[model samples]
Structures are given as structure tokens and as C-alpha cells.
Target: MSKLGENLLKISVILMVLLSLFLSWKIWTKPANHQFQDRTDKVKAVIQKKEMTEVYMPTKLFYHHGSGDHFLYTNKESTMKSLHEKIVSLGFGSSKVLSTAEITNLTTKRDLFNLVYPSPIPISLFINMNNVSATLPHDSKNFLFNWLVMSLDDNKLYFVDYKNKTGIEFDIKGNIASIASILDAESNNYVTAILPTDELNYAGIYYLADSTKLKTYSYIIATQSFTTFSRGFFNQPNDLFSNEGENLSLSNSEGESLTIDSKTGEVNYFGKLKQDHSESINELYYETFQYVEDMGSSLGNLRYFSDTGNEVIYRNYVEGFPVFGDNMKGSMAATVQNKNVFIKANQDTLQIPLPSDDSVTLVPTQEVVDSLINKGVDMSKVSDIQIGYKWQQNKETQQAIDLVPSWYVNYDNMWMTQEKLESILVKGGHS
Candidate 1:
């Protein structure tokens, strides 16, 4: 009786263990169902994710000799990307404030390489907005500057505001052998440029010295995800619905709305905002990052174009030139109203580059400015002037666009073409 009972108990125990193992294998092999939004986020993740430095990169790079002449490398895209990685890899040491006089004096004996940002970016903005852990120091913690210049002579880097004439300076960590090799190798494609010292009318803007040829590109464009925007810009995603009108109107019961223009494919979103301080630029920066997870658009090389106190703008760039147009062609904006934030973008973004045989050569910046002044473009209203690729439709196809290089005048921070300004002046109307 004892032997049979013991054997039966052993058999029962083995069966129970086998059953548990079978159940565990089933749990491991069968896929767990995910929620709808979670799956949507996974799809978005495949397309959208960008670093702040990746999006807010410097627009221009200049190699300056000891004699004070500046040169721009024509191999822009590859050169800049490699150089950016190298500089950040070396990181930075302690930085001290350098007055304009100090910078000028220091430049007298140094070979300078400058990386010019489109706008003065603050350190706090990167930290609060994108959680960037850059190698900036405590002394240079919050310096605001648009220019990041490298002094190869002293192995130093200066982050300076050209107009303000003040910036933080930090000594370099290593020798300039790597930087020198790249510059020397790419010297074949270097082009002459007019900096602040060369031309007064450049007005803190850099210009190509002569007429240059640039390729025109065509792109297959698309829009930001409606699902992502609803979750982000609205109070509740489920409660938000749309109306089919002239514009595709999106709204929730919580007084937030976003409208997409059907004809032009422009997007304008409005939402209630709560910030600790009204004048805090950092607050706006954080809000900008929260609503838009990534500044990236498909097939678009977007960078920071400009920012006023109340708004920030980013535009798609090709070979160092910003693309400008109202049909949203790749322009993005974040604006802060009194108690609300307005996020505006084109319903379409550049997706795929198409083949193009088009190219354009425009007159120099000085000649363009002179023509504008002759045409009665009021100088007082013009805050900044720049060359941009005017985004237009291709006559043959609806799938692509023509990017023509043209001079644009920024009227109090608003950009418009020279022809538009001339028309306004002719009509006795303000631009």
C-alpha cells in the first residue's frame, strides 16, 4: 500500500508541473493586445523623433584666415555634419565672458572658424525644452549668442553675439589637427563670403560674394499626424471631432481648436495655455517642445530660422538657404497669445526629393538691397533681409515644387518677397 501510494503521488506531482509549464509557454507565445493609442504612438515613433541640436543647428560656417578674410565651404551638408560631431565630441571647458573689444583684439592674431546660428539660442532653452546635457560650463551657463567661433590659433571657441558684441569664451580640450585636416581637404570647394567686417549693409548677415548657382528641388510632401496632434494640442483626444467645411475644423468641448485649410493645406492650432510667468521665454520654449515632439518633417532639412519674443519659426533649408512661402512649404511657427498658444504649420511637409534639372543664379545681396531701396522699400520697416529659395509649384506636375533663390525682406520679422514689397509700395499700401 505504501509503495503504490508513493508512486501515485509522484505521478500526480509530475502532471501538475507539466500543466504549469504548458500554461507558462502559452502566456509567453501568445501576443498581448495593445491599446489603439499605444499602437498609433509606435507608428509615430518610427517616423518622428529628433534631438534639439539636430534641429537647431547653425546655418552658416565660415573659415577665417589670420589676415581676416572669410571663406565658406561649398560642400555644406557633409562638412557641417562631420564638423558638428567633432566639435561636440571634444566638448568644451570653462568659459568666460568676452567683451566685443576682447573678441576683436583676440581675432587679430587668430585663425577663426565661425558657425553662425540664425538666432541667438540660450542654454536654458535646450535644457528645459529638450533635456540636452551639453558640455557647457557653469560660468557660461546662460550666455546668449548666435555665433560659435573657433580660434584655431589658441585652440579656443567663442560663443558670441555679433550685434550685442558679448559672448562666452572657452578653451579647447585638444589639438586642432582633426579640424585642420577637414578644412584643408575641403578648401577646394571654398567660396568667398562677405561678413560683418567686409560689408556694413550685411547688417549682421553673411552674404555670398558673387552670383552662385544652386539646384532647384522638388519634394513629395505630407502633413503632421492628426492623431498625434489631437492627443497633444487638445484636452481630450476622444472628445475631439471634425467638421467638413471650407477648412477641416478640429475641436473639443474644452474650447481648444485647430483648423486645416483645405485649399492651401495650412494648419493653425489654438489652445488654452497656463504658464507661471507671461514674459518667460523659457516657458514658450517648453510649450513649443511639448506640443510638437519633433521638429522633423519627412524629406525636409529644417533648422531654426528666426524667433521673436512671442513666436519662433523654423524653415526647411536646402544647401544653406531657407525655403520661404505661405503655402506652408516647410515653415513652422509657435506663437504665444495672452492666455493661449497658437501652433501653426503647413498641412503638408516635404516627404521625398524628386529629380530636378532646374537651377538659378541670383544677384548679390548688395545689388538686391540697392534695387529694393530704389523701388521705395522703406528701410525703417525692414528688420532683416535674407536670401531664400522661393517655394513654388512645378508647371508640369502637382507632385513636386520649384525652389528658386530670391532675396526676401523681413518687415518687422515677417518675411515677404521683394516683388510683393514692390507691389505694396506701388499700391500705396503697407507691407
Candidate 2:
């Protein structure tokens, strides 16, 4: 071979060697947070899959006597689930959009009791939750309602899609007398709470008419094994590997990964997911439910909070109020990306309730709002306000958590502690 040709061949070989070395270094130094290395065994924990009816039940229950103030089911454990099941079982005859005149009267009229969800949900899902899987029309599958209203004097039922200021009417299909009795009996269980159906003209927010005290609770927590996540998410758990770090990260060659925080027991998982672009709203919910069911663990009464088009969030509800925090104490979320699914779940969850005497006295809703405004929070910017439990984890141990009663407000679409919102808006507040 010519000398010049030999020189060119050597240069090509050197270039090839350099490319290989660069690739090796990139893989070697990949951040430990998501480094791809070892195999994990299948870890199984028995957490029963919840029925659609249980998780998707209403979050709020209120009764209106028409002439006077309304009453709220103040018992911390929500009575809405039992109510929802009864209503769903009773069935419906027809649905129609509420007339403009009727929609206008929703706030002023006090003759109805309603079950409210945290956000809008399709009517078909409501029906399916009853365990009656019937094919529904496109309208029912897509029509969403924030609350289901039932007439106390009359047996008429309505599903209000608050966003559209429209609603569908349904004839109560079952025994009207039985339904009436149930609502009537609730009078004994409800606390006299004032809903600003007069001035603010909204029925969503409920204010305890008098000073009432709620108890705080501590719970012994239990976390699912890291391997449970790996086995549930990845098709091949044997291919995933983990290291001894503060966070348990399991990865494989197939591009699926799981990261679990050792302290908080929060989990972040990314996996190859195939979703049908044309799937109906009902299908989306069903599939997500299956995914949650597949991943077994100790989930404390997780209830569907909302679906924000981008993601679906389920929160932990205790004694009728939801527990909230950045950590996934009683929460799990599912999001679908292009050809992939990302899930955020918590391994650590509140389990056994510990005996506690801690209790907090919360003022009336009007007072809570007034105080917030006095503290410089712009009430107009506040879209939502309610009471819920704030999860406070014990710093000393990972196995304990405290649920503290606190006020939460949706400020400019962001939900935060009333105190946090106060701090943010204290200086002239946000417009």
C-alpha cells in the first residue's frame, strides 16, 4: 500500500477510537440521579384495587331548605359516597341542558341538596362508577358536571356543568320516596352551615355558622418496597437495577425508569406507554384506573380529585377532608405523554391511626375569608377556598405523619396554604 494511503487509514482508526471513548465516558458519568445500571426483583404488596364508584365519589355534600340557610354534612367523614351510590343505583331517565332561566336560579334557590366533586367529571363516568357498564352516548361521555343537584320537595335531578352555565336533567328512575327519605334523614346528620347563596350567590363554599373544632391526627406510615414500583411499571423488572443512595433509582435498557425518595417515599416513574389518540374520555379514565390498580400498595382512601386535561390527580381523603402537601402522602397522579406514561406515586402512606388528643378550632368561612382579605390577600384572585388537612411528616422518623386542619385557597389557580398565600400577597397583594 502507498505510504500516503497508510497514513489516511491510521487517521480513520484514530477517529473511530475517539468516538468510542466519548460514548463510554458519557455513559460512565451519567448522573447518579438517573444512572442506568442493575436488575431488581419483583416486589409485591397487596393493596386492593378500589372501585370506580369509591374513588370517584363526590367530595362535598350540602342540603338547602329553600326559604332559609343551607346545612353541610360537618362530620369529617364525607357522607357523599353513600349518597352517590344511592343516586347512581336509582338511575336516570333523560338528560337536558338547563335553561338559562333555571341556571340563573341555582344560587338563589335553596330547595335542593347537591353532591359536589372537586372538579368537573363526565356524566358517563358517574354512571359507570355504579358498576353498571353501559354504552353511553357521546354527549354523556363528554358532558361534565361539577355537581349533581336533587330537588328536596320534588324528585327532579340535574347535573350542572358549571363552566357552561348549562346542565342536563334526569328523571329519578328508582323509588322517589326512598330517595326523599335519605335526604330527609340527613337533616339529623348535618350541621347548620351557611352557604353564601345570597350575596356571593355560590353554593360551593360552606361556612360553619358557629365556631367548631376539628381534631388533628397522627398516623403510623408504611411504604411499599421500591421493587413494587419497578415490577409494576416496567415490563421487565429483572432488567432494572438500583444502588444504595438516598433515593432508590431503578433503570433498564428499555428506557423505562423509576426514582423513589428514601425519606419522603415519593416515586417518579417514566415508562414507554402506548395510548390511543382517539380514545374517548371514558376510556382514558378506565385505563388510568387499571394502571393504579396494577401498582399495589397502601393507598389511604385515595379519591379522584380532578383531571386537568394534562394530568389526573387523586388525593387522600380522611374523615371527609383531603390531606394535602408536596409529598405524595395520600396522593397518586398519572400523566400520559407521547408514547410514554409518567406516574407520580408515594410509597409512604398514612396507615394506622395513632391515638391523639390534638384538635384545632377553625373559625367560620366568612371569617376565614375576611381575615385573609385583611391580611392583604386579594379575595377576587382567590378562585376557591376550603378546609383540608395538611400533612406534616415527623422529622424524626419516616413512619409517622400528622394531619393538621388548615385553610386552603386557590389563588390565581394555584392552591396554597392560607398562610402561604398571605405571605405572598401581604404586600399590597396580587391583583
By lDDT, the best candidate is: 2
Best by TM-score: 2
Please write out the lDDT profile of model 1 over residues 218-306, one tens digit for every residue.
Answer: 66444444554555555445555566565657676677888877678777888876343455656655556444544334426667777
Model 2 accuracy (lDDT, Cα): 0.68
lDDT by residue (tens digit), candidate 2, 1-431:
66677557545544554565466446444555444322443134344556666677777777776466556554434355556666767766655667867875765566677787887888877765666434443456677888788875556688886545677776666666665566667344677776564434233466778766889987766556565666566665664556557676787778877887866668998886634533565765765665566564356677788776668888888888888977766788888756567888887677667555669998777887887867866555665677889989755344467899998887777778888887776665564
> TM-scores, in order shown?
0.78, 0.81
Error of 1 at 68 (Å): 5.9
lDDT for 304 in candidate 2 is: 82
Q: Which stretches of candidate 1 lie over 4 Å from their true place?
A: 1-39, 66-68, 73-75, 105-110, 126-142, 196-202, 223-225, 272-281, 294-299, 337-339, 376-383, 426-431
Clash numbers, per candidate: 0, 7
